[model samples]
Structure formats: C-alpha cells, structure tokens
Target: MDDELHRRLRIEQARALLDNADPRQAVMLACDLLMAGVNGDAVVALAAESARTLPAYDANRRLAAVIDELGLPELDLPTAVALIAADTCERILDCSIPAEVGTHRLYVVGYEGSPLDHLLPEVTALAAHLEDDLGGRADDDLRTRLGALARTILDRLKAENPA
Candidate 1:
C-alpha cells in the first residue's frame, strides 16, 4: 500500500481503538506508524492526540507511559503509567494483539528496519540505567540473563543486516 493510504488506515484504526478506551491498541498503532516510515514526531503527535481525546481512558494513560518511558520531553510520566495500568490484563491483551500484528505492516520509506526494532536496544539500556539509578542491583544470574538476551538481539540484528 502507499504511504498516505497506510498512514490513513493506521490513524483510523488508532482512532477506533482509542475510542474504545484501548491504550495498548493506541501504542501498537503508533508502533505500526513508526514501522511504516511515519516520522517519529508524527507518531508521537498521533499518540498525544489519542491521549487528549481519551482523557478518562486507561489506554490513553498506558500509551502516555510508554511515550514517557521513551523519554519524550512532551509526555508526563507517573500519570501516564497509572492510566495504562488501570485496565485488567484481558483488556490490555485486546489492545496489544492488533498492534502486535500490525508491526509487520511496514513501508519502504527510508531505513531498512523498523524504528521499534531499533528501540529495543534503547529500552534495554534504559532498564539497566534505571536499575542503577534506583540502586537496585540484579543478581549475577539476572545480569547474565539480561546480557544473553542483549547479545541475542544484537546478533539477530547483525545477521539481518550485515555491515
């Protein structure tokens, strides 16, 4: 599909999900946009719009949390996290599944990989940084597990796009 068409579809899908109070769906929709070569700023803007329209909805909150966790200066943290976690797991699942499926829907706008895929490293790094910031030390086994996971992800990325 064309970029404009894909973006419109994503926005429409996102709107429907947000209207249903599905924050996870909103996040996934944002991710799909990112994967489709939508600008990060645009994706963030769409997410912000969803949050604004669904102020009382939990999905709005969760999406805000993810945005905050991404360190976007425009987003608030605690409030977003609270909103996201308010819903039960089942509701979260409903929001998440579509987003997960939509991940594969990419467009050849520029880069060869999904922006979300690249953010995995940033997520892991942030987790480690937070662990250190909180003075919460992981056991050796946990550290090993995390390291292994990092290496696995890196290896996969490297294999997929050799330098």
Candidate 2:
C-alpha cells in the first residue's frame, strides 16, 4: 500500500479503538501515530474527545495517561475542569450516566478556576454546594441545577462548532 493509504488505515484503526473507549490500545496507537509523523495536536484532540465517552474519573485518568505517554505537559486545571464538565453534561443529558453519579463526579472535579467559573455565574454558585458528602446524597435541586448547566455547556459547544 502507498504511505498515504497506510496512514489512513492507521488513523481509522485509532478512531475505532478510541470509539470503543479502550484506553490502553488507543494510547498505544496514538503513540504509534505520533512516531509515524502524525500531528500531535490532532492526536491529542482525538484522545480528548474519546475520553468524554468514559466516566469522569476514568476519563480524566485515561487522558492523563495519554498525555504522559506523549511527553506532553501536565493536564492543566482549567482544561481538566472543561473535560469533566463536558463529560458530565454529555453523559447526564444522554442518560448514559445517572444524575447522582454525574453530579458527584462534577462535585469531585470541582469548578475552581475553570472557564465556567468566569463564563457561568451559576456554576460558581453551584460550586459552593459541592462538598465531599454530595455523592449518593445529592438532592433533586442539585440534579436540576446541574442539568441546566449541562444544557448550557452543550449549547455553547454546539454554537462554537456549528459543523
């Protein structure tokens, strides 16, 4: 096969592995792609997008591992927050994850200096209530608030992409 065809095949395989959320295989293939002269930014973007399909903790952990393997800088606080927010919102809205679990993950992730802190006052206010005890004990009020925030983030993302 030509080099371009071979590269395309590898890219397709990487996408398939990522879609399956197989962290180990995906990262290994990402490394291979990098070694083969694929763009690092593209690989990182693909890895980050795939991480969203996982549970919050798992996604963060897996993405961190990928960054480490790629010799990238540590995952910054704001980026981590964004990833967790996007994951929490997407999973909750799709009902793929329970509201309690999603909120608990959000509570754990914390908003801190995230873009949400500046862009969404509601998130900062909500962050005040996010204590360690919020896991199984999350209230309906928390769920409703989180759902609203999730919709807002998703809508914003859609507007930004619009593709």
TM-score of 1: 0.23
**Model 2 Cα displacement at 11 (Å)?**
20
Alpha-carbon runs more than 4 Å astray in model 2: 1-66, 108-110, 118-145, 157-163
TM-score winner: 2
State the weakest 10-residue window (summed lDDT) of model 2: 11-20
What's the CA error at residue 31 for candidate 2, in Å?
13
Error of 2 at 151 (Å): 0.7
Tell me the tens digit of each residue's lDDT in model 1 across 61-130: 5555444544544413322221222222122234442321211121111122332244445444535543
The clash tally of candidate 1 reads 2
Native-referenced Cα lDDT, model 1 = 0.40
